[model samples]
Target chain A: MYERFWRLRGDKTTIIIPGWQSMSYLSDTSNICWFLEAEFAKEVVRLHKVVGNAVTEGRHIVVGTGSSQLILAALYALSSPDAHEPISVVSAAPYYSSYPSMADYQKSGLYKWAGDAESFDKEGPYIELVTSPNNPDGFRRRSMVNRSQGLLIHDLAYYWPQYTPISSPSDHDLTLFTVSKSTGHAGMRIGWALVKDKEVAKKMTKFIELNTIGVSKDSQLRAAKVLKAVSDSCEQENSKNEESFFKYSYKLMAQRWKQLREVVEAGELFTLPQFSPAFCTFFGQEMDPQPAFMWLKCEGDIEDCESFLRGHKVLTRSGKHFGASPKYVRISMLDTDETFIQLIDRLLAIQERE
Target chain B: MYERFWRLRGDKTTIIIPGWQSMSYLSDTSNICWFLEAEFAKEVVRLHKVVGNAVTEGRHIVVGTGSSQLILAALYALSSPDAHEPISVVSAAPYYSSYPSMADYQKSGLYKWAGDAESFDKEGPYIELVTSPNNPDGFRRRSMVNRSQGLLIHDLAYYWPQYTPISSPSDHDLTLFTVSKSTGHAGMRIGWALVKDKEVAKKMTKFIELNTIGVSKDSQLRAAKVLKAVSDSCEQENSKNEESFFKYSYKLMAQRWKQLREVVEAGELFTLPQFSPAFCTFFGQEMDPQPAFMWLKCEGDIEDCESFLRGHKVLTRSGKHFGASPKYVRISMLDTDETFIQLIDRLLAIQERE
Candidate 1:
């Protein structure tokens, strides 16, 4: 896990927050997102540049409690306030399970959930969430609607070099990234959006202001320090001798995927998505896509894959939650080593019974 | 002023967060509020017990990004899902300015802001916000509706002895508190709610889960440390040698209030609220109210009090924001020493101009 890299670094990545530091609600009052700490924004830009994941130049950064909040903020900003009805929000099938509920939980008049972007045929303005190297099923995706009326929110949570090949710097009107997925710091609850439109950015900032006042400054400072360490590890001279954070993470993912594939091949009871090798600009070589989740389909008459897996003492998200059939389930490839091993072992045991 | 106490404490109140710490989303998965950090919750309970401001026994603690988020969550939890229309949310006149916007920003179907709790006569399932030692005005409040159908959310953000007399340990069914107002750690963005009902607590937790997934574990841990330090300062058992956090804070507030009163008396243009001495259980003595804000009402001629003060280079929140007459303005008493002194000097200059 990424924890090992941080653990080895020791105090280099440790952040000491004095009691008097960042005691005010405002971080940079002049900034569009006033609550965003300047240092945290700087680090976000630096990390994206280093990874070649997203374009940050000329883009406004809006920090949030997490990408979850950002998702709703994007919906709120993109939707027409004066519209006759709530704007429809859609994501492709097998999308993030929480997306539908998050949009509709408030039952906001501004926006409402309209499931499965692929099948969406509404005649008005709509917000499409495009999660690349998507959750549940880790396939590279583009906006399915491909219509001028469709506003896009690109959730690039798993676009890091460790999970997939960095094709190019992603250019989008609105792109979201989280420290949780990139640095494995989920507990920090820090995420940001790179918005091209100033009006949209301001609206997003307003949403955050009305939501939680602002994101936590303590977490922001901590994130800044952690990100600095990450960038520092890769930029250091003679870094070839020391494994870079991405390089280390990439190797681990590759190993895990290799192990998982071999088990699946032996079991012959499930089918995992096949991804063709692609050249990674960051790594400067052809690399296999090692996604954070294994989208598994039950073979031959296994109608309920999630329930079947649970029977084997292996838990997974039912495809039903993702607006797909129960024959498919998504299992995380990013849990701790012990837990991952236990999952594989349980799967193998189920395979033996067949 | 409280910052001075924290700065003097040096490393004792400081929090050192390692890069590898709290990397997961879950804090205490077994608790009713799964995202609530055990340490933070423990410290919250400990602080409440130490201060005797609120009862913590058998109360479910739901942690949030801040009290702003908790306010929304309380509304979400208390509102009936089966209600024919959005539940009416009412607070007394000159209420916290943000309450209306925060409630209706999304134009949520669950609840709608109905201003001025004192005038709210509409029946059937209304939410009444009672902010004891209220924001802007600093007046003690009770639910004015006085009906069984009225659900109450007690915002105890300024209930500390430094702001007002802690007359009794508040035993409200749902009470909210924030570290920002209590400890002046606004940047931490931590708040907690003590809920008596199990279903309500779960619903509040669900609201948080959808809003941000969870509160920041880093901030929670930092808050835990800050609060522990606060309680420790009071329970040092050193024969009254060292000043407790509240004792030091109370002295600063008392002094500031005295100076402001003198300046206002000389100006003869602004009338400040009068407070009768009341017994404080924690302090074990009668004490005058020293609120975090100065609610100033213009005597005559100056119709727009906020604009009038702005002319004197003293920035204050206009009463219009709090749904009050332009003759009144709210000035913060919690700014830095330099800012407070500048405000006093500016007011003295205004008096001379008169």
Candidate 2:
């Protein structure tokens, strides 16, 4: 797990915050995203440059509570406030499950959830969420709705070298990335958006300011330190004792995927999507996809995969939540070593029972 | 000024977080508010018990990004989902300026901002916000809409002894508090709400989960440490070497108010609110109100006080934002010593110019 890497680093990543430090709500009043700590912004830029995963030059970085909040902010910014009806917000089938409820929970007059971007019809103006290395199904994706009136919000939460090969630096107008998936720091609730347009970025910033009065400065500072440590590890690649963050995480992910694929092949009860080897610019080698979640399909006569797994005391997200068939389930591969091993053991037990 | 007290305490309040600690998003999965850290919740209960400003027993504690987020959470929880129309949200005139926008910015169908709780004569269910020791103008407030369908959310952001006298343990249905105004740790963006009803608390938690997934664990941990230090300071009453947090802050606020009042009286350019001394349970004595902000009204020919002050190189929030006249302005008394002195000097110069 990525935690092992940080544990080995010890006090190197520990941050000390004094009582009087960061006491004010404002970080940089001169900037559009005034609540974003300058140090955090600098580190975000540095990390992206080090990994070459996303384009950061000339982009306005807007920090949020997490990419979850950023998604909402993007919707708020892209939708016209004075529209006669709420703008239709859509994503391809098997999109992130939370999108529908998150967009429509408050019943905001500016936007409404319109399911499945591919089948979205009768829409005048729409916002399309394109989640590459998509959740529920770890396949890379692009915007499905092609229209002049369509605005795109790219969610690249799982585009890191460990999960997927970084083909090239993503050059999108608005891209969201979170420390939760990248650095395994979900508890910090830190995420940033790379925005190409100044007005859109300002509106996103305004949404955050209205939502939570900006993200937490404590989390921002800690995220900066954690990210700096990540970049530092990569920079010290010549030192045999130091392990590169991506290399270390990629190894762990690759091992887990190998074991999982073997179990599925032997069991013949479930099938997983096959991924072709791709050359990664960041890793400087060809690698198979080692996604953070397994898009598992129940083979043969299994009607509901999630319920079957639950009967075996294994928890998995139902594919129905992701607008997919009940025979499919999304199982997380990002849990602790103990949990991952237990999951594999449970799957083997089910196979034996069969 | 209380920063000096914390600074004097040296590294006693310093926290060292191991890299692998608190990585999971789930804090207490069994609890309704799954992301509320156990340590932080315990500290919150302990602090409330120590201060006696609000009741903590048998109350469900919900943590948030700040009282700002909690306000929205409370609104979401209180409003009926299938209502014929969006529920009207009202606060009395001179309410916190951010309330209207924060409530209605998304133009949510769940609720809409209806101005002035006192004059809310609409015949339907409504939510009233009562801010005790209210922002802009520090004064005790109660629910203005007297109806069976009226729900109330109490924002007690400035209820600490340093700002106002703690009259009694407030046992409201839902009460909001934040560490920002309480401990001057605005950067943490941490707040909590004490709710009497289990269903309401659960709904509030859901709102937060949909909004930001959860509050930041890093901020919650740091806030817990800061609050524990505060309660520790109070408990060490016998140690003359250690100044209690409330006593230190109360003295500083009291001193600032005295100096400002003296200047305003001598200058005869403005009028300030008069306060009746009240008994404080926490301080164990009667004390005059020393609010964090000054509500100053322009006298004589001054039609717009905020502009008048701005002309003198002083910045203050206009009373218009608080639903009051332009002849009034709200000045922060919580700025640094240098800024406070300069503000006083500027006011004195304006008086001399007259």
> How far in Å is the alpha carbon of B16 misplaced in model 2?
1.6
The runs of at least 3 residues in candidate 2 whose Cα sits more than 4 Å from the true structure, single-residue gaps closed, are none
Tell me the tens digit of each residue's lDDT in model 1 across B1-354: 588989887577789988899999998889999999999999999999999999999899999999999999999999876778999999998889999999888999999999998888997889999999998899898988889899999999999989999999999999999999999999899999999999999999999999999999989999999999989988983675888889889999999999999999996888999988899998999999999999999988999998888887888899999989989999899998999999999888888988
lDDT of 1 at B35: 93
Q: Please state the error at residue A129 of candidate 1 in Å.
A: 0.2
For model 1, how does the per-residue alpha-carbon lDDT over A1-354 read when each residue is reduced to its tens digit?
678878988588788988888888999999999999999999999999988899999899999998999998999999877899999999999999999899998989999999999899989789999999999799999999999888999999999999999999999999999999998999999999999999999999999999999999999999999888888877772545777788889999999999899889997799999999999998989999999999999999999998888888888999999999999999989999999899888778888898
TM-score of 2: 0.98
Error of 2 at A247 (Å): 0.7
Q: Score the docking of each candidate (DockQ).
A: 0.84, 0.73
The residue-by-residue lDDT of candidate 2 on B268-304, one tens digit each, is 7899988899999998899999988999999999989
lDDT, candidate 2, at A300:
91
